[model samples]
Target chain A: MTRTVLEVRDVQKSFGAVTAAKDISVAVPEGAVFSLIGSNGAGKTTFVNMVTGYIKPDSGSIRFADRDIAGMAPRQITRMGIHRSFQIAQLCNDLTVEENMLLAGAIHGASGPSFLRRAHDPEARDRAVATLERFNIAEHRDRLVPELSGGVKKLLDIAMAMAGDTQIMLLDEPTSGVASDEKFPIMDLVMEALRSTGVTVIFVEHDMDIVTRYSERVLAFYDGRIIADDAPDEVLLDPEVQRYVTGTPA
Target chain B: MRSKLFLGATAAFAVLAAGSVILPDWAMFLCAMALAKGLVCLGIVGMMRGGVVSFGQGLYYCIGAYTATLVANSFGVSDIFLLTLLSALACLLVGMAFGPLLSSYRGIFFAMLSLALSMVLYGSLSKMSVIGGTDGLNIAAPTFLGWAPEGRPLQTALYIYVVAIVVIAGTLMRIYFDSEQGLITLATRDNELRVEYLGASVRNIMTYNYVFGAVLGGIGGTIAALALGHVDPEFAFWTTSGEFVFVAILAGYLSVPAVFVAAIILELVRSFSNLYFPNTWQLALGIFLLVVIVLLPNGLGSLVGRRKGNAA
Candidate 1:
């Protein structure tokens, strides 16, 4: 059996009277591509946030590589090899695409960022450009981030998260802002780039078609609980998942 | 590009140093004071890059001036170099103490908190009678490594010294602004959340920037105090802090050199306006600021060239 990379057991979180996560428990095996499917307030993002250390679970443990990582700051968790892309692309609008990539490389570089070394030295530029090329966004590297299209911004956001030695990549709606026609292509590029590195992928996506196509395992969430957990076909076919998550009558 | 900047800085330093010989003593003194104020403004510019404006940098400025003055008076140590170094060291210690707390704040909270701290210093200094209270204390003319010069020669020596200090400080600041940590500061200003998520500590970056600002402010204050031959509570007053902010806003957060240029311009304009209009000099300064803001929203530094494509 493949080793478990992320193990979430009895995780619970609440916001006042409303429960955002209700004893959510799941174990993600190494190199598995998991897609979280849920309706509007179904705890899908809460799960991602807790795992990425964006939110603290009120109870229970989240273990990554056998170490409990609950309540750690986002940066600490990120340095521990779990990285996430935001639902809305987080980019430095004033900077060019290449500069953004260069910044990421500098931040996650082996020596860490330095006060004496130039940030955009030739080596950093080359590495940034190479990453941009992998995402097929190298052509737009010179353009400022604000000037880029929504699809390009999303690509850049995910690309930046790929910096350093990321073990598990959590993508929060990787293709949310892209045009309908461009979603599959973007996902294909992202998945190809990620899969080649053998990093585990967990993406939160609203598109059922994309989920069915890309995810090896699917999780359906409803009212702060996992309603269905199995392969994509099995989960999609589950009556409760169809009823609550996909809004389809079984 | 680095070589070019180094050459340009060298050329500028040479011209300014050369000016001391030809210019009148009053002009040299004015230039020295303007550059001193520019150093404080440079500190503000440093923090501004991290997306925070400090309204109370005068706290460090006052601390620096007072530290230098107290050391000089109490020990009869009149070396300008030693005084400035001590002033910087004092500010560094104070900055380390306050930086973490201040770094936790952002936007107007940081501004007001810093401003409040400076006002507190101003108030306390105003009440201290032994330190001369509202009248403040006078500083003896500074000597250069045991070589005490009086009259015109003294002013010229001070002017040359100020020019050299500014050149070195400005060059080091430029290098810092282009360094990895400096770019992180710029990125922090743009989107602090993203910076944190990228595995870097935003608080640490902000704290470092704040400490840098404090040191720069201290050095500037020491220079100003030495040039004026006086240390006063007015140095910590809100209006004095506001003037440094004015220069910072006028300079923008772009090029390091633009800061001093903006400072020199403000000094010249204020001097000429005070001479010509006397009563309406404040009105003149206000108009100048408004005009510059309207013409260059990014400040005078934007005119140096759009900072794009890693052109620094």
Candidate 2:
């Protein structure tokens, strides 16, 4: 059996009158590519937030490398090698694409951010460029983030999250904002780049085609609970998943 | 790029240092005062890069002047270097004590909190009779190391001393602005949440930036105190802090060297306008600032070259 990289047991979270997560539990094996599918307000992003420590679960045990990170701060969780990219690309818009990548490398470098070393020192620049190149956005490295295309920004966001010894990456919506024709190409680039690094990927996606194509396993969420969890083909065929998540008549 | 900036800064420092020989005594004093105030404005620019503006920088400025004056009067320390050192240390301690609290604030809250703290200091200092009450205390002419120069020589020594300090501070700050931590600060300004998600503590970064600002403010206060031969609670007044903010906004957040250039310009305009316009000098300064703001929205530093993403 593949070793589990992330284990969430009986997680429960609520926001006042609304329940965002209820008894959510799932175990992700090392190097597995899993996709989360759900309708709006169906607790897909909530699970990612809890795992990445953006929102503390009201009660749950989130184990990553034998440590309970259920309520840890986002920065601490990030330092421990669990990084996540936002649904809306969270980038430094004022910085050039290369500078943004350099910042990520510098922050995650062995020495951390330094007062003495230049941010774009040769070593850091090479690493940043390499990551940008891997994401196929190296051509736009000199352009400011706001000037870049939506697809490139999303790619940069994922590329930045991939920096520093990341073992598990949770992409909220990698292809949400990309144009239809460009979505498949961007996802191909992102998946190809991510898979080569052997990092376990957990992506929340609304595109059934992407879910069927990229993910090995699928977790379908409805009303803050996982309605079905199985192979993409099996999950797509499940009556409850079709009715609740995909909005298709069963 | 780094080497080019270093060479340019060194050349500028040399030119300013040489000004002591050709400039008259009054001009020398004016330049010294301008540079000293420029140092305080530099601190404001530092905080501005981190996406917060401190309206109470006068708190550290006043503290530095008083610390130097107190040390010289009570402990008999007359060396300018020693006084500036002590003042910087004092401000560093104060910054450390207050940084964590202030780091939690942002936007207008941070500005107002800093302003309130400085006003508190101003009120306390005004009421303290032992420190000469509202009249303030006079600081004696400071000695360089052990040498005591009188009159013109003394003014020249102080002018050269201010020039050297400004150059050193400006050069060091330029390196800092280009450093990894400095880039993190600029990133924080743009998207703080993204910075946190990148595994860096935004609060810690803000705290460090605040402490640096405090230390620079302290040093500037010491230089100003020495140049003016006096210390007063007015140093902590809101209006005095407002002048530092004005210089910072005028300088923009782009370049460290532009900060001093803006300060020097403000001082020159104030002096000349007072001579020519008299009662309308404030109006003249206001008009000049408006013109600069309207023409160069990014401040004079834009004339140099725009560095992508707030690179100082």
TM-score for candidate 1 (chain B): 0.97
Cα lDDT, model 1, residue A183 = 98
Candidate 2 lDDT tens digits, A28-60? 999999999999999999999999988999998
What is the RMSD of candidate 1? Answer: 1.3
Chain A TM-score, cand. 1: 0.99
Per-residue alpha-carbon lDDT of candidate 1 for residues B1-312, written as tens digits (9 for 90 to 100): 689779988998999899898988788888999998899899899999999999999999999999999999999999999999999999999999999999999999999999999999999999999998989999999999999999998898888898998999898888888888988999999998899999999999989989999999999999898889898899999999999999999999998889999999999999999999999999999999999999998899999846757423
Which stretches of model 1 miss by more than 4 angstroms? B310-312
What TM-score would you give candidate 2 relative to the actual structure?
A: 0.98
Q: Where does the lowest 10-residue lDDT sum fall in candidate 1 chain B?
A: B303-312
Cα lDDT of candidate 2 equals: 0.92
User: Which tens-of-lDDT digit does each residue in A1-250 have in candidate 1?
Assistant: 8999999999999999999999899999999999999999899999999998889999999999778999999999999999989889999988889999988999999999999888878889999999999999999988888788889999999999998899999999998989999999999999999999999999999999999999999989999999999999999999999899898888
Query: Candidate 2 - CAPRI tier?
Result: medium
Clashes of each: 0, 0
| lDDT (C-alpha, whole model) for all candidates | 0.93, 0.92
